[model samples]
Target: MTQAPEDAIDVDEPLAPKFVAATHDATGEQVPTRDLSELAPPARPARRWTPKRVVITPDALDHPHAHRIVERVEARGIEVERLRANRLTGVRGATERETYALAKSTMAIVVSPPSRRKLQPIAPSADWRVDLAEGCPAHCQYCYLAGSLSGPPVTRVYADLDDILGGLEPYLGQGTITSRRADRAQEGTTFEASCYTDPLALEHLTGSWTRAVEFFGQWEAPVQLRWTTKYDDVAGFVGLPHAGRTRVRFSVNCLPVSQRMEGGTSTVPDRLAGLRRLALDGYPVGLTMAPLMPLDGWREHYGHLLDLVEAAVDGVPDLDLTAELITHRFTPGSKEVLLGWYPGTRLDMDESRRTTKRGKFGSTKYVYPEDVMTEMRTWFTDELARRLPELHVLYWT
Candidate 1:
């Protein structure tokens, strides 16, 4: 097997293993049980760029925002291979054989990074963003992935997580290096998982997030593993080895938005209930009110949501009351992709007051002006401070 260059696994100290293996029966056949230690980790799969029978268009791979994705992937010592997806089909219709074939034929793949160009760097909050899966199943009308992914939504788990983690082992012990910095108050590094996919949507099938929860538990300085989702699948999370480091954040919208815009996603109330259950089980739970949609009666809609959140997790212990709020914005290039994906989407498409640049554009087009942002900030700050005074208000940007 060809080894990745030394810079790929750049750390001086040898780190402890962070994963363990278990076995179960495959179908009805009894499988031989062996530890992961018994076998060498699998090789990095080869990348194949086979063109499909369907007619290929230049627009398929010509995403204006592809450079951002290339930069992110290449920074990690991985190469990006752009393939023309010959076929586009809903994942639900893919047969078991087809699914297996797709998995076997691919190495590492990259997609256009989603969302508004400038994600307001809300102060250092989440410790670690965990990437459990690569795509989401739920179809929110305003989904960032619509612009990010090239084809229909299909959740893809990088089957070589063991290898990825093995590659990450050397840097795991560097937590103490930052403890010596004088000017900076050092905390654990934040792993932003689900930046490309929703962790809980197809978690039952993949069990990748569960494996992550277990892996992050053993680290010494306690890296924060943050997973956000619109799904309310809580059964897999109950009593898992989360070790108080894994924060299960639910991405919620008002009932009106949920009803009109979000498709195949859990209701806001059900997601709140899931958060409550996780908080009660001593897991760190967070609330993310992202892509804050501006529609008629918007204040009333968000007000009701605030009430629901307070009612659910007010007295719950270890509940991380740190909420994130981002308004609707889109780059011109992404707007074309998004509108193409969801033609009837009611996302604010008025490009009047947006910042224009080479490939990115977004509505600094505030649903409400600076005054509204001030008012909303004040209202949330006061209400959260009053209800849960000790809870850390991690970030508001």
Candidate 2:
């Protein structure tokens, strides 16, 4: 592999740029309103994810949250059944692919206890990750959580969430967000919520994320709750008293790649529309252009993406936009799991097209070669700076 050029975008590099159109009062001072009706987007199509099966653990049978979830599911004419306390009764199929698909469409309601062990650190995203749920139901071909979780791939939403949020009290004022450098003195602590699952996907059934949002809204701390989603389910979240404490980033990519690789999720335009709505409501918003595949005609592909983003968010007042850029990389175990799940997928997981890169815990994954990475990252960072002057790139990895 050749060495990257000196101008290549480095991982975890922080860049803050601003591009707000100025409006002056008679006194020569800038005055702005949070009105976004001028740049309001059209209605975007919504995703309808009805799980094929709903299983409840014995302990969750009488839980309040579980009862509400069951009522919601049953209201839609779906019946629920009970499972053994610590067992998945029937989640198997004849072939590996069939089993994988079945598990994806199944939802398991369980009572998960708070971890007595230390919480996991999610660097470059947040200080500590506190998972409210464990799995996602979206069938994206590039599902990196493929082999990462234990047990079957059933989507599990915890019933014991009060304990989970309660456990974070001791961890505040002591995370990477505030202690990193002199400039981060104000951001007391940060927690990443979507480390293992997309919150919006499960928010509909469980209403657990809505609860978490309320908890963060009332807490009188300098804490920030961060989570990005591929879905545009914000109806349950809007109009909440958030106190500027939550940042919702939308995971997006070029059209061809998103249509081909990501199924059962909102389209790029729809996600941008959602981002516009949330930003209009005064929630700090971000664009998470992740698993960046330098496909054919790569420049035009992502250039169009930047154009859409600019049009969607050009006029919102007091906009605090940030970007998290993540290039595509996959481990061998994930590759195998994905192959079994979607044997006919057209995803580019070829070993020849990627080079080996070592990750945490001595794990190695295949990533684009240095020259390719340098070219793509350089163009993206430069284009983002040129288009959205007020955007801050939190990190690139």
Candidate 3:
């Protein structure tokens, strides 16, 4: 096994110690502080200011997983106030019932189930849209979840796996159901896992992803379990029972963008190393260059990235290289949240080029116009073909 280099980017250095310690304590282990740093960071600081009152409504407390998480929070020396429905109105925003429902649902299933209800039925897709958690531990400015949820950024673990798995048994038993459209036939039943949370960051605690991997291993039909993450941790997946049913995809970007926007996330080089490891372990590894930020010297930046990827796993005899690319898009609410999160974020949010969809949806006018897109597609396709001809170029969205 190839080891991550000593000089490889250390995105977890700042918070690793705290998270590691917390995890050990939660599991009832007395790990030395020094040892915790070597493994993983504690989830939060050892000493934090306690709110005068930490309130959780009755409805929120009803979910077994939510109650466990709340208990975990309190155990860490934080003062928590459990409030019934009557006290929720004093909290803020939506009604007590609405707030409780959202909190309960969000924390109910640690893993978000794949939505069988397809937004685009013509395409091949997965029924389970599992959202294991909300708010990534890593702070990436381009995160799509910013617009999808309502709350502060947090890493919430859902402890009830039996409930989640019980709900998914029916869908997994169904055989290969191909989409009617010709374009969708190639890709079938896709589970979008990393949209709201980074599966790897909290895998040590929840192990929900590993459970999914085991579940899919026994699946009879062809199911594509897609997990997209910017984390470089692969220790949990090295020898798991993945059985090729799960595609452990890494979301990558140019080095500059990664350093600037994807703060607290693993560097590009480290991520590539993890990908190489997964590939060597016989996992179906996919590469996603998503929300491809348009930056100065874009071509040169991407060129270097492609070069690094080619070199990372170039001669690996038994590896599957599937690459997917997507440009950036932002809903109005997302933009508002992003602007607030990153007051002086440098990304270009030009409006003229973007077309307004349903009044709220807004994306780049054309991340690349037809001419640019054609050039980019050709460049990427040609390079991958020349370097790794046997690999599959999954999609260029």
Best-performing candidate as measured by TM-score? 2
Backbone clash total for model 1 is 13
For each candidate, the alpha-carbon lDDT, in order, equals: 0.53, 0.77, 0.57
* Clash tally, candidates in order: 13, 6, 26
Candidate 1 weakest lDDT stretch, 10 residues: 46-55
TM-score of 1: 0.63
Model 2 residue 160 lDDT? 68
Better of 1 and 3 by TM-score: 3
Deviation in Å, model 2, residue 14 alpha carbon: 38
Local lDDT at 225 for model 3? 69
Overlapping backbone residue pairs in candidate 3 total: 26
Tens digit per residue, CA lDDT, model 1, 24-103: 12121223233332222222221112211112122323432234323433443444444456333333226544542343
Global lDDT for candidate 2?
Answer: 0.77
Query: What does the lDDT come to for candidate 3?
Result: 0.57
Best by lDDT: 2
Give one digit per residue, the lDDT tens place, for model 2 in 205-320. 77788778778777787787889999986655655666667789999999888888888898888888778877876678898898899888989988999999998897787798
Q: What C-alpha RMSD separates each model from the true structure?
A: 14.4, 10.8, 10.1
**Evaluation by TM-score, superior candidate among 2 and 3:** 2
